[model samples]
Target chain A: MNKTIIEIVDSLEVSKVYAELSDPQSGGICVFVGTVREVTQGETVVALEFETYRNMALKEMEKIALEAVEKWQLNKVVIRHAIGAKKVEDPVVVVGASAPHRDACFEACRYLIDTLKERVPIWKKEIFKNKTVWVSAHP
Target chain B: MEILLFGIAKDIVGKSKIQFAAGEGQPTSVKELRQTLESAYPDLGRLSSMAVAVNSEYVRDELILKPGDEIAIIPPVSGG
Candidate 1:
C-alpha cells in the first residue's frame, strides 16, 4: 500500500529484486544475499530446508520493513526469503534497500536482515546423509 | 481476550488465533499466558525456547497483556 515499499516473495528468483531496486530516482540500492554454503560449523551440508509459520513470518517481515522505514526514513525496501528445500550454492535469502543516497540504503538493508534473523519466526533444518540438525538462530 | 500466537505456538495449538477470558481487574502477563498454554496444550512444553513479544517488541515474563494487542510467541529457529 505504500508505493511498493516492501516486497516479500517465496521464490528462488532473487535477481528480480535487484532489477526492482534499479529505479532512476534511487541513487542508492543495497543488496544482500544469503546463500547455501557447502559447510556449516565444520560439517558438510548437503541441503537445507526452510520452514516458516507463513502468516506470522509475513507479519514479522512487514514489521521489519516498517521499522526500517521509520528508523532511516528510507524510500523503499525489499526482502525475499526462500522456503522449502534449497541446495548448495542456492540463494536462500535476499534483502535490498533503495534510497536517495547509498549509506542509508546499506545501513537499513543490513539492519533489516540482522533484525529479521533475530526476530522472524522462520526456521531452518540442515540435512546431511548421516545426521540432521535444527538450528534455532542464525549466526 | 485476544492472544497473539506465532510459529510453534500456532502449530501446537493448530490455530493462529487464540482467545481467553480476561476477567475483571485481572491482567495477564506473558509468563502466565505461557503456563496456561502449557496446561491447555501439553505439547508446547516440549519446545526448546520461546520468547514473547507484545506489539512486535520483545518483553520479559512480567510484561502485562492488553486486549487487542498483537502478541507473538517466537520460537528459536535457525534461519537467515
Candidate 2:
C-alpha cells in the first residue's frame, strides 16, 4: 500500500518522519532535512522565521506529494515543514520517500523539496541583530 | 472583498488582512485587483513577482473574483 504524509507543524521531528516513511515492502528510503544556517552572504542570522497560509499550504503540499508518488512509484512519502522562529541548526523542513529501489526514492525525495519550495505558500524571514529580511521578496 | 497578505506583502500592507466595502469600486478580477493594489502600494509593484490565490488555489489573472471568495496576495515564495 502507498502512503502519503504531509504536515505543517510548529516544529519538525525527523524521527517521526522517518517512522512515517518506513514501509514493509520498501527496500530504499531517502530523506532530506532543511536547517537554519547562522550565516547568509556574510550576515549573521540570529534566527529564521517561517509562516504559511495554512490551508493553501496544505493543499499545495498534497499536490506535490501526489506528483512525486506517481512519477517515482513510491511506497511512502513524507513532507513536513516547521513554522515560527527557528534557531541555527534547527530543522525547518523534512521530506522523505521510500521505494523498492534506491534511485526512485532518491529522486522522489529531491522532487518533493524542490517542488515544495517553488509552489508552496510558505514564506521565510531571516532575522539579524539590527534588521529582519523576508527571504526572496525582491530580485 | 477581503484579501489576506503574507510575508513582505503583509509588511507592505501593514496588516494580515484587508477588506473592501460593498460600494468601494472593488476589483472584479484578479488582474484588476493587482492593479488596484499596485496603485495603492507602489512598493508591492517592485517585487520580483506576485501571485494571487482564490479560495486557496492559484488562479490566473483573468479569473473573476467574488466578494465572498477567499483571496490572498502571495509574494515570491522562499520555502524549503
Candidate 3:
C-alpha cells in the first residue's frame, strides 16, 4: 500500500513535503519544487498569482497520486500547490515521492508533476511591472 | 443554473458565478451553454481553450446541462 498527500494552499514548505514523504523502508525520496521566476521572455515579473478550482484540483491530484503509486509501485507520494500571490523565488509547488529504491521514486516524482501540469485545474498569472497576464491564455 | 468561473475567466466574467439561461425553457447541452457564453461575453471566445465541468467533473461539450447541475468554466491550466 502507498500513502498520498495532496494540498492546495497559500504557501508551501518544502520541509513539510519532505517530512510527509519520509519512509523507513524507502532508500530514496525524490522531491521537486517549482517557484515563481523573476523574468519571462525578457520582461520582469513582479509576482505570480495562482488560483484553482479547489475541489476539482484536489480530486485530480488525488487521482494522479493514487495512479502513480500503482504504476510506479511507490511507497509514498506528496503534492502541494500554493495559491494567492507569490514573489520571485517563492515556492509554488512541491512534489515528493519515496520508494524502496531510487528509480521508482524519481520516476513517480516526475510523473506526478508532469501529470499535474496536464490535468490539474490550477492556473497562474504573471504580474508584470504594469499589467498581469496568464502564463498562456487569452491576451 | 449558475456558471462558476476561475482565473482569467473570472476576470473576464467579472464575477465568480452568474445565472445562465442556456436554453430558456428546455434542457441545454454543454455546447449550447458555451455558445450562449461566447455570444454574451465575446471575451470568452478569445480564450485559447476552455471546458465546462459538471459536478466537479470535466465533461464533453455535448453533455446536457440539467437543473441543479454544478457548472464551471475551466481555462487553460498553467500550475506546476
Best by DockQ: 2
TM of each candidate vs. truth? 0.72, 0.97, 0.94
Residue-level lDDT of model 3, residues B1-80, one tens digit each, is: 88899988898889999885545643388988788788889999999898888998889977977789888999888999
lDDT of 2 by residue, B1-80 (tens): 89999999999999999888876678989999999999999999999899999999999999999758999999999998
Model 3 pairs in collision: none
Higher DockQ: candidate 1 or 2? 2
Q: On a 0 to 1 TM-score scale, where does candidate 1 land against the true structure?
A: 0.72
Interface RMSD of the predictions, in order shown? 4.3, 0.6, 1.5
- Tens-place lDDT digits, model 1, residues B1-80: 66656555666788887766668623488888788777888867777777776776668999878778777667685567
True contacts kept of 1: 0.44
- Residue pairs clashing in model 1 are A135-B78, A136-B77, A136-B78
List where candidate 2 sits over 4 angstroms from the true fold: none
**Worst 10-residue lDDT window, candidate 1 chain A:** A1-10
